[model samples]
Target: MANENTDEGLKRVVGVSGLALSIVNGVIGSGIFVLPAIVGIAMGAFGVFGYIACSIILAAIMLCYAEIGSRVTTSGGSYAYVEAAFGNFFGFVINWLFTFGWGILGSAAVMNILADSLAILFPGFANPLIRGFLFFVLIGFMVLINILGTKQGIGLVKLITVIKLLPLLAIIIFGFSQVKTGNLHWEHAPSLKTFGDTALILFYAFAGFETSLGVSGEFKNPKRTVPLGICVGGIVVLIVYMLLQIVTQGVLGAEMATFKDAPLAAVAEKIVGPVGATILLITAAVSCFGSVSADVMATPRTLFAAANDGLFPKFLSKVHPKFATPYLAVLTYGTLIFIVSISGGFKQLAILASAAILLVYLAVILATIKLRMKKQDAGEKTFRIPGGLVFPFIGIAAIIWLLTSLSKWEILSTIIFIAIVCIIYLIMKKFQNKKPVETTLETIL
Candidate 1:
């Protein structure tokens, strides 16, 4: 339970392009492909406004991450930042919430989506046995790729990202020409509750960018790389989301909600007929795989980092002598995803992922404020948010507003999950025979 080893053999080879593409893959996942229809159904033509609002809110949140990520260049992205600002206890809580609560649930949901998407092209994938087999094959491939090396893992992500974007870009380019101006007209503005709910759902599409930073320990010149990569990647995501919404809404019009299951493909079909729909289906599968590939490449580092900090099993921190990767952590995380994906009920739990990620963002934003005030890494140069406390305060308020959109059941579930995490922490602490490190705001600052 001693913090004796920290990033002992992890390579600092990830540069700006690798980091930014990883962020792009992480953010532009299965959610974007289907959320557009839901948003269109909820707010009609005004849904574009919801996308913009979420983008602004996320921009503020990412600014906080940019600052904190630069200041604390460790493996566990959000966990590392909060641990630096606070201490082990809060860090442990965030670790469970971020890594398991959000990461596993979100990725498993994507894996299921991948199976469903593939099933459209090949009906065999619909069978439980075949679907389970597909999950094993895909998950095992990702696990093996990551265990081989970070470079190889990220290389696969890059390939799949390009493959996934082509059909989406094709739809955007062709679908815009087929837009009926009358379809974009609306009679009334959405209510406050409707808009907030729409924005909350859109926020999930942007949530995975933080997971990409989980490999901060393997980043070269993190102070520069983290902020720059986040800025570039964020801009690309905003543009893509805005264009996709405009094209889909403009073409589909009031009937956007009718294709909720495969909205993007509907747009593709409208753009170029049946062939376009087929292409989009393949793209959906590729996009899901790409996102999970990035997740596999990065999120396990949270386990490795936590293990090094003595918060998790020591074996999770072990680096492969040949590959210099956190091989065990990668295997453990991949195994969890496989089990969850094959278990076949994660779609409902996907809501928990949204709630959990909002909490993680809240913690990171708060950590940003505290870390800045305390000047945790005063000796090192780091990116600082332009506004004194304005953005952080805005991020906090925005997160709180989004949390209100959650149903009571989700709220209760998150509370219960946190209680379970706390109990686990206490058990771990007892087993390690170490007293909890008292970490109050006053002491941290």
Candidate 2:
């Protein structure tokens, strides 16, 4: 057994397949299951166009991350990249927004959504007390499994990923034969507001690829595999999401836009009957579980990184005495998740997270451009984005343009979130700079 004081850390046990699957798992959460109808309702016949546009945007962002990620071999992912390029303050801000919006509240949303999904099996799950109990249990389960070790946590991700994909694929395969092409027709042109809403929803669906980049330090050949896996994974997920949208939209037709809920299940029932819908519903719940588990595995690394950088409490950086995992960070995240899950206000956090991540993506793209300008002569074996500054520039512009589509409340929430983060950063910086004055008691001792 390895001792806590051995200084051993996370291992490079994850292979190409594991990294690729993690991306797929991270990106294809419960969001995709509901997006078919959401986009269909907004875009009408133009809905597929929105999917294509968002996929391009996401691909550009992922490319920036892939290139930047290859240059650094660290645990913090984007936070590490940004700090190395800009400075510590920028890194702390992004880390704080990410940890608060996505890590804590976002994961809580999944737990609540999973609890709601569980309500399908047991009607009593709709009760607040019972639902809160299950929510606590699920978050606890993820933290405990993760605290045991990375290998074990990733193993769970692999298994749940497979479980998450099967029903979606089944829907696509079977729903095709049952497609009523007449249902695919649109009756009207959507307004600009509709287009904006669809675009935002589509963009949010592709947000989780950073989960893999976070753990690139555990990849055997990060420079080569990180970029390759991300691109491959991005393409794979894009195809899956496109096919899912097409299949669900085709199967449900005009009715999709109004579903506001499990539109995919409605399509399943039309094709495969009640059993298929039940399977899809159960899979949706498990997908939420898988997503929350992925966050538990990846998000705490940001806190661990922050603590090491003196932005957070030192306790968050401690590796488990027996497991070598960032147990304290995991525990911290789990606790916040549990608290937020009880409040049931994750939608607001989800909106704020979506807004914050766009700015974060812009920062990463800028970091990539900065690194390239600096390392033009430093020949390193790193993954390079094809087409140079074109994609990075496009990514930056796209994110800024997308930010305009955010709801007013979301923009306000984002501003508040940033303000809070900056305040905390100032306080931490002051504390880190303060030297202990030798008191009389200390001098006497």
Candidate 3:
């Protein structure tokens, strides 16, 4: 089939390395740096175990997504997968909420970190207005970098990923040596009552693994690569998170680490002194920056796909003549992030964004089952998930359990976001009633 859009041939050449980098970039963001403190506060010495439990659950969820990605290679991630298995309208609503709602908020959280770090480095620059302006400027810089196209954007992700991991690795190595295991009180087990909150917080840390699925169209061999990347990348992050938590607990103990906002930095100072702490601070900033870059690269593809299908403003689908990239969509998402950054603080947006993505995750798990049954007659299987059908079934069940664990406010906010997206989707459907149907599995693959 001939490519429909003139610029549709602008392929993203992200191989296994780029895919792994994107996953790490997605997982490591602001959450790892700050979330340990919250987890410690809630779960105490047992927070490390909570992290491990969340990692296992996330790995199961990733298995479901890997099945979907193997079956349908597309740019919109869960939206495209669910749409392919379900229907266009349902997919549109899900995609709309995923991209417009959560994507914008996630980007804003990263920008918030950049702004906060800048304020810390130069105390006089802490004015709200100045911080807001600088936040937008930082978003613009990332937008421009992505506008240069996928390879360029991935290159930037690689650089920042390396820079971000250095201090984290240093902390784990040096901080472990300073551990006084007596601080881990065996009696201080995390109560089962707080498991729900721990799961919610852990969700934030693992929320971005789906990002690798977003660029499925760009992978050299998505079936093999996406699953491998998701599994390997997830394990890598799980180890990193675990090590960081262990070092934090061992070095600072549950009490001090739980209280400090910059727990890892505090540990670094104790182990390797002030200079080490400074390096960790810089790493946190770079980690946020790298996540922003990866988000810039991947999320706009959803807008581009939506626009191509007549679900969004058509112009957003237009690729840049020079860069062969979705310039308009990138700017559109960036603008939303800028507004959110100025209007609200990072912590609120981060939690809300995590909630939104969790909703999309539920859809992805169901989509996996639907596609498996729908495509069974097709007799085409490049990669089947281990444990036959049992794994995917358990995965879907786990997601449902997690969904109910969300706080009442998070659930209410998610509903409102979904309703708003449905309203917009209906409006677009009415306007494009006479237009040719544009979304198809073949075109997307």
Candidate 4:
């Protein structure tokens, strides 16, 4: 156990397959099952084109993160990138928000799905007290999984990912036979006015691609595996998303767009029967669970990294003596998630989570540009993004474009989140700096 701890702390063990699984599990969640309806409402059939465009944009951003991860293989994702490129304070602030802001939001979204799934099984489970109890129970389950060990948590994610993808793949295949050509109406063309709105919705679907980078330090050959895994995993997800969307739209026409919940299940019911709808609901529940599992595994790593760097409370820095995990941070995150899940509805929390993640994406792109200029001799990055400076530049621009498309309320909420993070960063920094400096003269006695 001690040897394993040393090796993990020194960057080893994880390989290409682990990295790929992380990326796949992170991105392939309820978003694919749910976001199609949201996007369809915003852009009609043209939303399919918008999803394609956003995939391309996300691919570009993935390349930028690949470059940064290759240069500095570390845990904490955007926090490490920003710190290496700019300085400690800015990076700490970004890391703080990335951990707390999105962590609670993501947890709430996942718990909401769990609660809704319970409501499906028990018709009268919609009571606020019942829902709240289930949410806390789910959070407790995830926290326990994480506290057990990283490998245990990741193994569960791998299993859930396979289970979740099966129904989606089945839907794509079976729904193809039931496709109606008349359903696809291309009367509306993709335009600037609609593009931004659609892109913002699509961004939510592609939000978790960079999650692997948060634990790059765990990878055996991070420089080689991280880049390839991110690229390949993202491309695979893109293909799956596009095919699923195309088949679903063909099967259900525009009716799927108006569903308040379980849009994919509604489409499945139209094509097959009640059995197909039940299968899709199960798939959605599994996907949501898989996402929460990945979140439980990855988010605590960021907190552990920050605490180790003296950017958070010291207790969070302690590793479990037996399990070698960040037990305290995991518990704390789960607790916060349980509290938030009781108040916010699933859709609202989903939007809030996406909004918080977009800010982190903006920071990552900026970090990439800064690193390229600052470390000119950083050597050949394993997966150098095509088009030297243009890709990262365009990636940053794309994130900025999406940010502007969000509503005024979302923008205000994001700003307030950032302000809160900055305050926490300042307090931690002051505490760190105020610690007495021990000198050789004092130690010699």
Top candidate on TM-score is 1
Query: Model 1, residue 292: what's the lDDT?
Result: 91
CA shift of 232, model 1, Å: 0.9
| Tens digits of per-residue lDDT for model 1, 1-445 | 1112334688777778888888888899888888789888999888888888888899999999999998888898999988888899999999999988888988898898899999988999999899989989999999999999887887888788778777878888888898889888889999998887778778877888998999888888888999999999899888888889888889888777678888888888877789888988888888999999999889999999999999999999999988889999999999999998988667766657767888999999999998777734447789999979999999999989878877898899899999999999999888676433434544777
Best first by lDDT, ranked: 1, 2, 3, 4
Instruction: Give the better candidate number (2 or 3) by TM-score.
Output: 2
Q: Which stretch of 10 consecutive residues in model 3 shows the poorest summed lDDT?
A: 1-10
Worst 10 residues of 4 by lDDT: 1-10
For 1-445, candidate 3 gives per-residue lDDT tens digits of 1112233645747777788878998889987877767776777668888887787778778888878887887677888888887888888877866775677777776777776776677775578878877877778988888888777888888898888888888888877788888765557566676877777678667888776566666666676778877877888888898888777877777566444688887888887778766777778778888887888888888877777776778888888887777889888877777888788754564555656676688788878877777635455656667787777666667677777877788788777877877787787777676354454544676
In model 3, the clashing pairs are: none
Candidate 4 regions off by >4 Å?
1-11, 41-45, 257-261, 343-355, 374-381, 437-445
Candidate 1 residue spans exceeding 4 A from truth: 1-7, 345-351, 376-379, 434-445
Could you tell me which 10 consecutive residues in candidate 1 have the lowest summed lDDT? 1-10
lDDT of 2: 0.80
- Please give the distance, in angstroms, between residue 23's alpha carbon in candidate 2 and its true position after superposition: 1.6
Which is superior by lDDT, 1 or 4? 1
- Segments in model 3 whose C-alpha atoms lie over 4 Å from true places: 1-7, 254-259, 345-354, 376-381, 434-445
Writing each residue's lDDT as its tens digit, candidate 4 over 1-445 gives 2123443343245667666777787888777777767666666667678878888788878888888888777667778787788777887877766776676677577667765775786766689897877777767888998787766766777788788888888788877898788766768686787677677777777887665666666666677887887877887788888887777667767777567366678778876778877787777777887787778777777777777777778787677877777789888877777777887753464555656777777788888877777635545546567788888777888878877777888887777767877787778667756655445547776
lDDT of prediction 1: 0.87
- Residue pairs of candidate 1 with colliding backbone atoms: none
Can you give the TM-score per candidate against the true fold? 0.93, 0.92, 0.90, 0.89
In terms of lDDT, which candidate is stronger, 3 or 4?
Answer: 3
Clashing pairs in 2: 41-257
lDDT of 4 at 256: 71
Give the per-residue Cα lDDT of candidate 1 at 245.
86
